[model samples]
Target: MGGFGPLETAGPVLVWTVVLTFVFLECALIIGLFLPGDSMLITAGVVLASQVSGEVHVWALSVGTMIAAIAGNQVGYVIGQRTGHHLVARKNGKYINTRNLTRVAELLHRHGFMAVLVARWIPWVRTLCPAVAGAAGMDHRKYTIASSIGAIIWAPVLLLIGYYAGSFLENVSWLMPAVIGTLIVGLVLGTIVGVRQYRAEMARPAEDFDLDEAEQEPVADSPWRRA
Candidate 1:
């Protein structure tokens, strides 16, 4: 899909504009990340490189993408803080998963910065991490700092890699279809795995069920012979 038709836009500036917009939207909106963020960044870079006049600048693309990414994550963090937990706990909410939230909360507690850093690289998890951090009662300032750094670093790096790859394959006739197909397959497999894990976790009893339900036995007195 990164071939001669739609990608062949009017000019470099216009192309980068669209790319930045998509990046921001994806980072902010829960459903937006699923859009072609990785592909667009790389494609934009590759397309710019191949232009005879080279009107599109790599630094511009990188900076614009980084801005969109950081801002998007910030918006997501605020939204999640404001209403995400209540929404998920609601009866009919579709976006929130209680099990995954709990697990990620535990991960955040255990791994802290590493969890946030690593989560930056993952797809769906990335969008949810900030919200999860907020909902899990983490300090807002810390979440903001970590998410801002993560978004800036993660988005540009991937875009650059894609840009180089796209440049390499600019002339190749067969590579585009193959990349799209692989992405689709990987997405499907990821969905299946996520669903299975969610289902399995939901089937387990609440961790505190036994503690909450167990009968209280009389305490044995210490043998100090006090009444």
Candidate 2:
């Protein structure tokens, strides 16, 4: 049965470092949208379970990865809070465009907490959701709570699955390769779609996304006016 290649040869220290780093980066940075963080995690577990003396402590790995993921989400949230205003003010900035930002704002308004929690399973969205939540003025405390819960669930499930199921997977040599191939295809497609969306969004008028002003227009006269 094949394993994680050189990662299997590497000691537990290197394995832990690599897996944790990718997990954090995937949760914190936009570049993580393309990184194989999820796959790396499960593969780490699979390699450890292969009984080749990987010696990695499962508890440490799970807890550390969970903390890393939560920390990463916080970092992303802060980044969004810091830069979201600038992005909104500008029409066609370099990285994030206003059109997409508008859509995220609407989404957060609709499903702030649930979106954050569920985003953990959604790869690219997992990387972007924290930032969008912050940018949309979602409650910081609520975002933290939701993201923490998501981390608790997301960080361990796949890794544990791979660890426990490694024996069954060992007999199915084609599965790992197929999963890897599918992830590669997804990365390419996501990159392509993101680029195309950014370009199209940049072409739209920024003023159209002034959602705050539109909402502030008062649905009805104030109570004081009734007198």
RMSD of each: 10.5, 6.8
Per-candidate TM-score against the hidden true structure:
0.64, 0.68
- How much is the lDDT of residue 86 in candidate 1? 42
24-106 per-residue lDDT for model 1 (tens digits):
87677655534555655655666565444443466667777878888887787677666533424222223234544555555
List pairs with backbone clashes in candidate 1: 42-163
Give lDDT tens digits, candidate 2, residues 73-139: 9998897776543334235743345555555555556666776788899785787677766654567
State how far residue 57 of model 1 sits from its true place (Å). 2.2
What are the lDDT figures for the candidates, one per model?
A: 0.58, 0.66
Weakest 10 consecutive residues, lDDT, candidate 1? 207-216
Clashes of 2: 0
